[model samples]
Target: MQAAEADLEADPRVAEVVAAARAADVRLVRFEYCDVSGVAHAKAIHVDQLAHKMVEGVGLTRAQMALNLLEQVVPIEGMEPVGEIRLVPDPTTFTVLPWSPGSASVLCDQLDHDRTDWGACPRSFLRRVVDRAAAMGITVQATFENEYYLGTEIDGRFEPVDAPTHAPVYSAIGHDHLDGLMLETVDALTAQGIVVEQCINEYGPGQREISVRHTDALGAADQQLKFRDTVRGVASRHGILASFAAKPYPDEIGSGAHIHFSLWGRAGEGGRSLLYDPAVPGGLSPLGRHFIAGVAEHLPALTALTVPSYNSFRRLVPSAWASSTTAWGYDNREAALRIASPFYRREEASYNIEYKVSDPSANPYLSLGALISCGLDGIQRGLEPGEPSRRDPARLSPEERERGKVRDLPSSMAEALDLLEADAVLVDALGPLLSRCYLAVRRSEHAAFAAADVDFEIRHHYYRF
Candidate 1:
């Protein structure tokens, strides 16, 4: 009946079904949604019922709200009132289940019982930050480079399958495990207009990396969450378990969820990238410099979300790509805020700022939001990051780093939680409700992790997915 409704209904997920539904003689459509922790879920609808669902949104038990915490589908008794939560179709997120017989899925946005946005929705959290950027005549563009791992069953134990299949450390030699799946996932995402940019095999055994094209911050975060779900779902149908854990092997190289950010204006005007500056020292725009300062200033507190697992700290070692310190670098991969290219002075060519602290387990919505919040705060306060560490801060004799004020993120989820607790500013940025929910979930996770016998899955999951 309306333009937006029509556009959503005609989304690729619904449109692709014409052939599959007709060929299979099916009369049902499925709509899917992701809870706070990024877990995916789906519900089916009769073909005739699609219009109402798309126009008005579908309803799920309110218990689903706790899925991010409780890790189960059903509502927990005494947890909260289990009424109905709405799943409104995100037309931009339609994709066919490549491994499924003929099923297609469209992502959804959450709605409360009163037909309003759920305060705790992760996507909405990201949107709030995006809106803030808009007010300042600034637009942040983001692209996610996800380094995930593939696992295997070893003698009744889950382990990183040895190369050929497991891919021994950084072996540039032939290993096809990551190749096929990488392209398949990318192609599926781009087909649905998700804008996948590049795919590569990582150094860790069974590790792979893929990144989306840089775009609006909100859209990038939304697409990243959707992309993770899409990849996991497809891998699942193929009988492969896609774990988004930061590290799956204790002794192996860990995985990272690198975030590359740029700046622009609303409606995509002015279109200048914020990372470069010909006037300021180090070729950084004042806004860019301030943003970097904000990130370095609040990195510890931000970790409660970016790498929020007990198993996560095991991966954030100094030597690993999972950065341990809060430092910036000009063209150094070892630093958290890597200037991907420092030699290039061109506005378009000089785009780089890597959040090396993130891992696959992170909620991209929260991670990116936290990042923008920190940066925007810096810009508002005109804070300068001081200086970019010329050498690898992680390796700089502790003495050298201290002089530079370089600091490590956190040694464990336990430490990260503590830092998050002390960060009133970040807590304010991420609402109290969400901050509490997140802290509760993370604390519980830390307890369970520390209590468990440090096993292969917990250690390897960091990279495996």
Candidate 2:
């Protein structure tokens, strides 16, 4: 307890968080963590106990991390119910819940009895990856551009809120239909310190996309959890359901949570853009090319982390705008890696790469951590990305695609898992404990889906994310 108190006291933000919680009359504080399946789980403490709990942390069963999407514990050694871990809240992430009265939430890291990071903690994994990048004089910034459907649930069925109107994509009418819901959602997010960059109606009948401004790698992952919780909370208050499932409805176009990231030099270098160079084509620096090559080289294995769920495969098809090939191109949405166009007068500042393979079903901390791990490997090895695809790789002749080194992404979760198991780089990055636990949990879910009916799959995934 002394060590825990010392750690909390050392962080200046902890005092401010306590003051804010007291001032806001916060009755309960939720200490939350996202599991490997991307499902958020929490334990609440009364405000009267928050100060103590903040130091001692709330206890969670080690088997909690081993639970699959269906709530069954996967048989992972050392993750049995006999052991206990602490959920230590990160003070910097403290925010009053705008939608839940008298409640506030904070993200947490799983710590062992000695207060050191648990080897299987996803948040800790991201922290390690961030430290690795910092050691090389680099900083990573990222954001998730997520699309979700807003609708009503009746008799265990989901129907879009705008099903009757059938508003056109990106149309003012579509925006008007969801104006109240989106407005409340954005306001709630902003109140919690999340910056809303843009919100628009999407292609599906009741689908919408909202993007937050980018921040440091860890903060970005934290914001993603905040974003999802805020949206779902606000939507429930409005008598609607919000689903970030990769494919909320089988017949409709799938939703995606694309990851956008950029690299910058450390503070000593005045934080210059590491991904930009005026002399290079598309303004991508040699280091940036290496990073892209690294991601492309390991895209298949990366998918096991980025698009981990079984339903995610339904969205990663050819011509779906969810890239199916490990090819990069300038502003090409069909390519797995897209060199996003820079904003006017902000070329260096705005230069970044977008990885299209990710979705909201992924645990942001793990997905982003795996991505950085791969990119850093590329930087260290000086890997070169092959020729950029001018057109969609799916549209190219077989020979042309093969000649350009464009390879198809994994079409199923099993395939992706196999690739993941074989990739030494990613396995090492995840560490032995985390890698084994993650694989067991994901593989269990895959097997359950394979044994169930299509309706079972849809029902379980629709609102879980």
Instruction: Please tell me which predicted candidate would have the highest TM-score against the true structure.
Output: 2
Give the top-scoring candidate (lDDT): 2
Over 1-465, each residue of candidate 1 has an lDDT whose tens digit, in order, gives 865457446665544444444555446556775554544567977655554466577877666656543353333442365567788866555555554545666667677767666666677778789889889988888888887766555665555433545554445542455556666777777755777666666776666767778777877876776677777766665556666777676776777788888876555576666667767665677778888888888898888778866666778777665678888877767777876665444546546687888877777788898889988888899887745778767668767786656887778778888888888778888776667667766676566656667773364343233
Cα lDDT for residue 33, model 1?
A: 58
Q: TM-score of model 2 relative to the true fold?
A: 0.97
lDDT (10s digit) by residue, model 2, range 2-86:
6545645766676677779989999999999999999999999998777667877899999999999999989899899998999
lDDT (CA) for every model shown?
0.69, 0.92
* Ten contiguous residues with the weakest lDDT in model 2: 1-10
Q: Quote model 1's TM-score.
A: 0.86
C-alpha lDDT (0 to 100) for residue 100 of candidate 1: 55
**Residue 94 of model 2, lDDT score:** 96
> Which residue ranges in model 1 land beyond 4 Å of their true spot?
1-30, 68-79, 161-172, 175-179, 267-269, 342-346, 397-399, 456-465
Where is model 2 more than 4 Å wrong at Cα?
1-12
